[model samples]
Each structure stands twice: as C-alpha cells, then as structure tokens.
Target: MSETYLIDRATVLTMDGATGATPVERSIRVHDGEIVAVAGALDPQPDDVVLSGRDRLVVPGYVNAHTHSWEALFRARLDNLPLEHWMLLSYPVLGLAPLSPDLIRLRSQLVAIESLRNGVTTLVDDVLEIPGQTEDQLAAVFEAYRDSGIRANISGHVMDRPFADHFPFLADALDADLRRQLDAVTVVRGDEYLDYARGSAQRYADYAGGRLRFMLGPSAPQRCSPDLLAGIDEIAATYDLEFHIHVLETRTQAVTGAEFYGKTMVEYLDALGVLNERVTMAHGIWVTDSDVEVLADRRASVSHNPISNLKLGSGIAPWRKYLDAGVNLGIGTDGMSSSDTARMSEAVKAAALLHKVTGPDYRQWPTAQEVLTAGTLGGARSARLGDTVGSVEVGKRADLVFYDMNSLAFTPRNKPELHLVYSENGSSIDTVMVDGRIVVRDGRVTSVDERAVLDELQARGPELRRWQDELETLNRALLPAFDRQYASVMARQVAVDRYSGRGECWLN
Candidate 1:
C-alpha cells in the first residue's frame, strides 16, 4: 500500500473533460497510485501526508506524444539541416556500431530525468536501433524506465526496406559504390520484427504495473514496404496495442508519396486499411485537406511536433485543419538532437503560438487552454492510455505536476493557463508526482543518482563523439549524391506548398 497524500486547497485543472473551462480551488486525495477523490476540501487521515497547496497550481502532468529518446546522447549535435539530410548522419545505414547495453540504459535514464524535470509524466518513445534491434538493448531501456518511475510507451521502430528507398532518384544520383553500399546493408525481415514484438509483449505485458507499455512503431510509410506496413497493423490488432508511425513530414516525403503510390501517404495507409483509431501519425505536415479528412474520419490522431518540424525546416503542420476536422491532436519534442530537450512546456508554448502565422484570423489561433489540453489529454488519447492517465479525476493515475505560483513565471498571474503556456518553461515546477510516487521534489529526481549519471556521460562524451564521427564520415561520403537527390526532389512541383515562403522557390 502506498502512502496517501492530501493536496489541500490548490488551484486544480482537472482536465477531466467534464471540468469547467477554468481551474477551481480543490483538494485531491491519492492512494495506491490512483486519485481517490477530488473536491473543495479533503480532511487528512492520521496516516496521510498533508501537503499545503497555498501558492501552488496543480495540473495534469504533460505528455510528450512523440520522441526519439535514444538520441538523447547526441542531442543538438546536428542542426540547420532538413530531416532527409540530417537523418543520414544521425541514422546512418551502415558503419555505425550498436550502442552498448549499459550506454542504452544510461541514455534512457537521461531522457526520463529530463522529462520528469520538465513535468512530463508520460511519453511515447519510438526507439530506432538503427543497425538492428536486440533483446539485451531492449531490456536495458525497459530497466531504465522501470527504475526511473516515469510512465512510458516504448516500441521498436520497424522498416523492412533498404534505406535508399527513401530517395526515389537514388540510383541516378548516387555512384555505383554508394548504391552497392546501401544494398549491402541488412534489413530485418517483417516477420522477424513481428516475432520479436510478440515475444517482447508477452515478456513485459504487465511490466511495472502498467507504468510501461510496448507499442508498434513503423518507421514511416515511405521507408516501409506495403507488406511490412500491413504486417505491423496485423500485429497491433493481435496484441491490442497502439501503433505509432511517421506520416508526410516534409515536401520530399509528399513527393515520395506521389511517385511511389500515386497518392498521399495518408491515402496509401487508408487504402491498406491501417489508418484507424489505433494509429498515431507523427508530424502530419505536408498533407492535403483530403488527408486531414481521412485522418479525422478514421479517428486517428496526429502527434504534432512543431519544434522539430521548424528545426528540420520540415514546415508547419495543418494545425487548424486537424482541430477543425476533429482530429485528435497531440504535441511532441521529436528527438533530443532535433528539439534538444524533452521539455513539454516548450512544445506546448510553440503549439499555442505557432499557428497564428497561418492567417490573420485571431479567432483560429489556439488558446492556452487548448494547447495545454493537447499536451496532456490529447497525448494520452493518441497513445491509447486516455482512460488511465492524463487527468486528475478519480480512477485516473496520479500523474500531477505542482507549479509554484510564487515563481517568477507565475508572478501576478491573471490566468494560470496563460502563464503556463506563455511564461513557464518548467522552472516553476515544484513537485512532480507520477503513479502516486514522488519522483521529483524540490526539482530533483528521487529514483536514481542523477548527478552520477551526468558524471558518467560527461566522462564518456569524447568516446561517444569519436564513435559518432566514424559513422558520420561513412554517411558524409554520400552527401554529394544526397545533395543531388534533394535538389531534384525540391525542383519537382508538389500539389501542396507547406513552406512559409510559398511563392518563392528557395532552391534557386
């Protein structure tokens, strides 16, 4: 039995769907990792721990709907590059050695630490092992999440096609040697990955008492074969798991869809009967209005990654279209190297403000409350964990973030949601509790030795960089080929223009 907690007289934003538009003064009771009661007042029992919430604002903990946590070790290492070119170096098809199991555990812990510090209690990690997936490495990630006490939905990113398939003109643009190099790279069979997922699901089905869930992650539509995509969907159905995948993120991807399938990637998925409620598409940019309609009609969700999309020059997603079409929306930080942090506050702010540039209609701009809801409840729904987490109502998991209203971010606060979306950036977070466990108090993690973890990473920085450089060198050798491919794709006209400078052809 866990210790009962009584948070008394705090401003609570329940986010329970039935709550009012604004927060109200309420006390919450928690025991056995669940919220037992919420009301105007709660009397503490003799064995209960009473916490005064006089100057605190309690809200549902943020959720990072999409992220590549394994890239934490090399965060912000590559910048000013588009998704296509950037991933070549970060996710090289060849010559990159697999990270040691110990290092994988350490990196996963780092992601959890940063996420907790940022008030993100739940996150969906699309783990891409690059060269291949292994049981030992997967176990290391699971161990880190279990020990760190943060709820996480993890998946092995699966793609059964050669990396070169992403570029339609690869054969013409690349030299024979480079083409052969790509061909020589081994890709696991679709059935093999399915088997692995099944084995892992059975092994960790009830892991950490629902604190951890194994999900299906297809790398992306263009990077995967049709059969593999279907197979993944089938596996998801068999296991009753939510599946996450990347959709049209960039102009190049939109072009790939037209050239490969003679339709949009969203339509391709729909044709395959896989774009349903169980699917969560990351970075649904470079999509058409019809694509948005399909997503909404199918009851699928979109994990909007504004920060990463901007960083990668992937262009802004159809924020208004998604919302207006009734598409369930979620926000994410993307990856450590892309957004450089696991902070949900930053993502929430971006989601709240970035859509204003779409047009002069201020009415269409996202409100602070809307973005905050997307960052929490919308994310939980996208991950298929809506009924369990993402709210402060009774029967929901006790994932709560208490913000110090006395902090500078909340000084003279008029609207708590506005302050949170416009001013707070995780610094105002005083305590973060997940699953009725105090994982963070006074801005420090209680689960693991954070300082020791940082020290080990600092000591190993040089070695990791050296190993990364070796892989970069191999990938960089094909830069000229990729450069040509990128130019050729950009030169071709796509149906939709998602870039900010729509009229101008920047390639010239």
Candidate 2:
C-alpha cells in the first residue's frame, strides 16, 4: 500500500477545534488514511492521486449520530403511528426478524452506501439484539459494519422487560390471556447481556484499524430493569464506553416515567447514576429546562431526530435551550422505519427549521451554523469521536465530503452555511471519503454492490412485508385498549408536559 495524496485549491470548510468556522480557500494533503496538512499549497509526489478542486468545496464528513441500520431494510413498514404503538405493536417485527447473516450484511451495506453517498462518514448504530441473539448474529452485525468501510459505534441494546411492560397500565389494559401471551417476552439475563456488551466492545473496538467503537445500550428506563441499567453502567465505566439509550422520545414515556418512578425518565436515570459524559440520550424531546441542565451538567449529549420526531408527532426538542444550557446536540436520521432515510442532510434541514413553532422569538430558532455544528462536531461527541473524524484538519482522519459547486442549489451561492442546511439536499455531494478511502464519488457508492444489494432487497422484500402484515393484524386487536389508556394518560398532568396542545402551557 503506497502513499496517496490529494491537493486542491478549492474552498475548504474546516469545522474543527473551536475555530475555522468560515470556509477558506486552501490546499489539502493526505497520506496513509489521515490528513497530513491543510495549507495554501502542497507539493505532491509524482505518483500521488491528485484531485482537482476547481468545482468542489471540501468539508468534514458528517456524523450521523444515531441510527438502527439493521432496520434499514424495513423502511416505511410502520408509519404515521405514535411512538408507543410503533414500538410495542408494529416495530416488534425487528426483534424476531427472520434474516440470515448474508441478508444482514447486505442490508447494512445498503445503509452504509446510502449514508456515504449523502456525505456521512460515521454512523453510530444503536443496534438492537435480534431475538435469541447468538454469537453468530452478533458477529454478523460487526462484520457488516467492518466490511462496509464506514466508521461506526455499534452499541448492542440490552433489555430485560417485555414490550407489553414498557409502559405503565399496559398490562392492566389487556385481558389476562392477552397479557399472558405478551409476558412470554424474550429475556436475556443481565450477566449474559453484559458479557455480550463486553465481548463486542473488545472484539470490535480495534477492528478495522479503530474505525469502529462499541458502546452499551441499556434501551430505555421502562424497557430495562434497574439492575440491568446498573450493570450496563458499570461495564461502560470499566471499559470507557458510551451509553446510547433512548429516553423520552414520546409523551407516553414521559407520562409512564412519572407514574412509575414519580419522576421523569431523565431524573430516574440521573438518580441511578447512569447519566454521565459518555451517555448520549436519543430523541430527548420530552425534557424540561431542568432536565436540560441536568444533562448539560453531567456533560452528556443528545442526538436529535427531527424528522422522526415530526413523523411520529413527537414534540420538538428544546434545541435552543439545550444549546443555551451547554448541552452538546447531535443530529440523526434515526432508524429507517422511523425517518425512512439515512440522509443526514434531511435531518440537518429539519433540525434547522423545526424549533420555530414553539414561540414568537426568532432568536430562539436554531441557526444553520448551529445545526451544522450539531450535525458535525456535536454529533461526533455523541459517538465518542469528538477528536477524530468530525472535522477537516491536519492530523485528523481524512474523512471528508466534496460538494460540487456546480449543483443547481448552489449555482447562485449566496452563503454556504445557509445553502448547506436550508437549500441543499445531498445531490451537491460529488464525493465522500472515510478513513482516507473513497467510498462514494460522483454521487454514487463505490465500496459495495449498491445495485446488487438493492436488487436482492427488491426480490426479497415480500418476506419482510408478510411479517409486517402478520404483526399489523395481531396488533390491531390490541390498539383500541392501548389507545384508550394512552389518551387517559395524556389528559392528566405530570410535573411537566412536553407534548404541545395536550394540556396547559407551563410558560407564562
């Protein structure tokens, strides 16, 4: 493997190290999968692969901070459903997915290709354990990430409670026979789950030359027992791993937490000593100002999924307040079933615009630059890669996106930041690189058989559709009772309400 170098005189946006916010005309040099220098000019070797920067703007690759890429194949299977219904009723098909290792690899590859083509270099897959999680299943997940050539933090989710028990009053709402049927939930022992977490962290931590990091996923407070959360926290502390857990993504979770623990789920986790610097709370929509402070004080981060939030009718997260409170904010496409796309630019645009509905203060709205930072550096913090790949700078890994200025969206080119977050979709991206490797160029995936993967999925789409139909039929019988219970909870008030129009406003 000889050295490779690239020199370009294009405008460069180095979203790096607390400075270099503006895009400047500069030249860049790369050697051995890392950036060696970024300056006005570079003398390249005769054999180096030199790329012209005449029509390109080189920027740091984005960190798609949170996702469940395994479910990428099941996009749009369940849509327009609330989080509770989606999780308990429709999305249960994920746990019992009848996929072989080969299918998993192809699905993950497709997800990687989509993300890479859209200028995302790192994906933090907060992956769930498929039912009867064998070593083979676990290894398949990591191997797919490795072979895909994208940086990832593959957190293995651990949950002890059944789907029926994730919310309070759920079991009570069902008949005895129905409740008994739901009680036969798969339970992986605490010790066993912890062992898997540890093994995965060790096995994949240094794999692919440290392009992968492993984290612990305790699921949510209601999804996992207290003991399990504690055990996970201990392992995370011992191994210095991050905790990627979903919290308060929906109003029902907020209501259920107050009823169960007499506190918010964030408050409960804080009491359990599980909230810390390494914890990245996903979809932190239903949090209060004090909750924001708590997270900020702990040095914790939040992965905001605006598209999924809007799709599920989850309320807008307090992004302005979170930023004001010094909380690191990250952007995500969530899972394919939730947002139905792995394109980070969609989430970036949504994050920039979704907060304007809450009040009349324009200053409180998230700016394109702020949201861009969230999509880049802040997202890297969520993945525990704050120092590595989120920025374009000397001594960092050469993970980059080259946006073509020739795109129609940027033809007039007023402000790059505004165009990036407001007007541009990913079509402006002409090239994408991860770990100094060109995975996407000319707006196409290069590292994998993209068409073959899509063709296989197209041919095999019915198997998943049939599973979805079966689950829909099974869940239709239970939605009436669940809806009633959910409505009852929504009518009542807690310490606070995060959902809009559900109750009285707390602000005067």
Candidate 3:
C-alpha cells in the first residue's frame, strides 16, 4: 500500500510525446510509486496528501546521464588544464590512501542533496573509488544513495591496464625513473574487477527498492586491455547491464586510437563487440562521420557535456551531426572537477546554445524542445531507464519537479520551454519528487541533514586539501610529457575537426 499524493492545478509540461506538446493545467495523481493519472481534475481523496500546485510549472525531473559523484569533494579544485593533464591531477596515477567509508557516504549524500535541490531526480554516476574499490566503500556509496531518496545507478569505475598504455607518447616522454615508478604502480586485475562486478550486482540488485542499480564502467576502452573489454562485454550480456565508458574525449585520445589500433575508438569498440544499445559514451568530442554512423547503427547514446568540454578545452562535439545521424543524445554536468556543479539547468542551457556556432545554418541548430527532451527523456533512455521515469506519463515513475511560475525567471513567460531553457537556472525549482516521495521542498532536501553534511565537508576540508595538494605535487612531474603529447596530437591532421576555431573558413 503506497502513499497517495495529489498535485493539483499545476501547469504541466509532460515531455511525453505520446501526449501533446501544449502545457496544460492538470492534476497529477501518484500512487504505488507511479503516476496513476494526469487529468484536468483529480479530486483529493481521504487518504491523499494534497500538494498545492497553483502557479507551479510541472515537468519531468532532469536525468543526469553521466557524472562522477565521488568527486564532489574535489569540486572546482582543478582548472585551466586539458583533459590529459587534468586527469592526472584528478585520478592521480600515483595512488593516494583511500578515503574512509564515512567520508564516502558524506560525499555521496552531498551529491544526492545537491542533485535533488537542482531538480535532478536521477543520476548515472560513474563512481571512481580511488586506490581501488572495497566492499565497505561500495556499501557506503550504496547506503548514501539509499538514504538520500534520489534514484541513482552507479558503476564502479575500473581501469585494469597500466597507466602508460592509454596515452600516445607518455612512455617515451617520461624519464627512466618516472617510467619505472609508473610501471610499479599496482592496478586491479581484470579478473578481480569482473568478480567484484558480479558480486556487487548480486549483492545490490534489490537495493533502495530498485531505485539504485549498477552499470559496468570500464573507465574507457583505451584504459582497458582487450581481454578486459571482452570480459566486460560478457558480464554485461550475462547480467543484462548497461555499459558506460568515456570515448574520444580529447584530440589526444583520438590520436591514441590511431597510434594504438589504427582506427577510431568507436570502431575499436565495435570491433570488440562492445558497441551496442546498452552502451553510453561520455564526451564523444572527436568522433568522425563514420563513427557517428556506427554509433547510430548500434543505437548507442552520447551524454553531451558542453560545459565540461568548454572548461577542459576539449573541443565541442558535433551536436548537429549527432542529431542528423539520429543518434540518441543526452545532457550531463559531468563530474565536479570539470563542471564544478551538478545543476542540469545550466547543462541544458549550454547544450541548447553551444551548437549554434557550429555553422551559420540556423535550421540545423537544436531547439528548446529538443534540448529539454535530451535533458529528461533522452538521458533516461541513455541510462536504460526510459520506460521507468523521464516523463509525466500515466505509467511512469513519479519523478517530477515543480517550478514556481511566480519566480522572476518565468515572469512574463511567453514560452515556458524557452524560458526554462534560457532564463531559469534551477532557482525556480520549488518542489522535487522522486519515486512518489517528496524529497525536496522550499529549496531544501528533506531526506538528509544538508547543513550537517556541509559542515562535515568543511571540517574535513583541511585533510582533503592536504591529500589533493600532495597528489598534485606528485603528478606535476608528468605535465611536460602530457603537454608534449597534447601538442603533437593537435598538430597531427585528424580525419574530422570538432573544434570551434580549428582552421580557417573562407566564405564562398
């Protein structure tokens, strides 16, 4: 017997295309963790909890298709570096001591709190457990999501191969002692990763009332050995799990593919039978036209992180090209280090405007409707949860957000979707419901003590900064090598250019 809730007289934007595009004043009836009805009038019953929705604009909650919740503590700490160098600082090839389970829970809880407050009800987090994963740490993360009242699908981000293999010229660039140190760094074996993944799936399959799920995170193809990739593909098939990996995030990565396999990363995955509908590639910035076709044919999705791409100096992805190819596109705020925040409104706004500069052809640009769909439904599809959430439909989960129309962002609102895409920055988010539970209201999360978590974060800041400073100092030795490789990759002629200002364009 699930609790019932009636949200009455709200202006709803059901992104469900089965329904019409018009925003209608409707009453939403939720029960049994699903929306039972959306009609013009749904009267409150004796057992129904009535929520006043007058002057509220209701829509499907945003789905963050790709993010790293583990890096919440490192938000805004890394800046002004390209993907290759920045990764070294963030992941630290030289391993640091692992974080305690309590700290992990605190960080994860903060991610959920911030996400719920910002109208994001679902998160696809590629959780990177530093130094390696442990059962206690995994449980801490799972417990945090379970307690926070937000829907989350997490992957234990894994990289089985050595550090030197992914880069194009790092092995040659490093000094002998540096090379020796890199070789000495221990990595989790492929078989161990597979075992852990299997065990984790079995352990957490029914966690958080099925709101918390697990996906396979290979980190990236280049970071995994061929056998490891094959093993992951096998595990995914056996368990029916979704796959998430970073692909061609930078020119350096593109060059690595050419240097390593004489093909693009997408082609490499396709060759290995890893490219399929179950896969979602993050930051596909430098894929070629053929690669786009391959992605479309495979029915794979791309989580476009425009803000992160811009911040990392990773080139803009071909948004128009991806759309034209009929590829499923989703928007993501990425991780804290690159995007600095988990606000999907900012990400959607960036996705809406970033492609206009791709060309002067105005018709090819994405509309407000397309971006909104990508932010909600497309992301849900990317996470393999399309049928469950992402829309305010009759049978979908009750993951909806209510925005105050009286807010300044919607003042004189001519077009609600346009204003949502352009003017609103999540400050208008008044109420957020996930799985039929009102977790956020009046700009605060109800599931957790946000003030205590924030205060704990501040209390632990000195230690975190000390660790971060030590990691930064240790990783600085490889900067010159990574810079050389980045320059080399940029100088080489790639098959396609995704950069906004890569070469000269002369008018005909």
User: What are the models' TM-scores?
Assistant: 0.97, 0.95, 0.97
RMSD of candidate 1 to true structure, Å: 1.8
Better of 2 and 3 by TM-score: 3
lDDT of 3 by residue, 1-508 (tens): 3799999988888888865335788899999889999998987999899988898989999999999987787898888999888888887878577889999999999999989998999999999987788889888989999899999888988998888877877777788888888888888899999999998888888888889988899999889988888888887777777789999998788888998999999999999988988899998988888898999999999999999999999988888778889999989999988899899999999998888887888898888878988999999999989999988999999999999989999999777888889999989998899999989989889999999999999998998999899988998998988777777767676776667722222121
Candidate 3: worst-modelled 10 consecutive residues by lDDT: 499-508
List runs of model 2 lying over 4 Å from the truth. 18-20, 93-98, 501-508
Best-matching candidate per lDDT: 1
Q: Is candidate 2 or candidate 3 better by lDDT?
A: 3
Count of backbone clashes, every candidate in sequence: 0, 0, 0
Per-residue lDDT of model 2, residues 1-508, tens digit only: 2468675787877887544457777788888888988888777778679998887888888899889876686687777788777765535622355457787777788888888888899998877745645667666777877776899888777788776777777676788766776677567787888888788777776888988878888889988989899988888888888889999888788788888899888899999999998899999888867788899999999999999898888877877778889999999999898899999999999887777766678887877778888999889888788878788788888888999988987879877777788888888998888888888878888778789888988898888678767766776776776887787767766555555522235442
Arranged by TM-score with the best first, the candidates are: 1, 3, 2
What tens-digit string does per-residue lDDT give for candidate 1 at 60-87? Answer: 9988999997789778689889888888
Cα lDDT over the full model 3: 0.88
Number of the top TM-score candidate? 1
Q: What is the lDDT of residue 392 in candidate 3?
A: 90
Task: Determine the backbone clash count of candidate 1.
Answer: 0
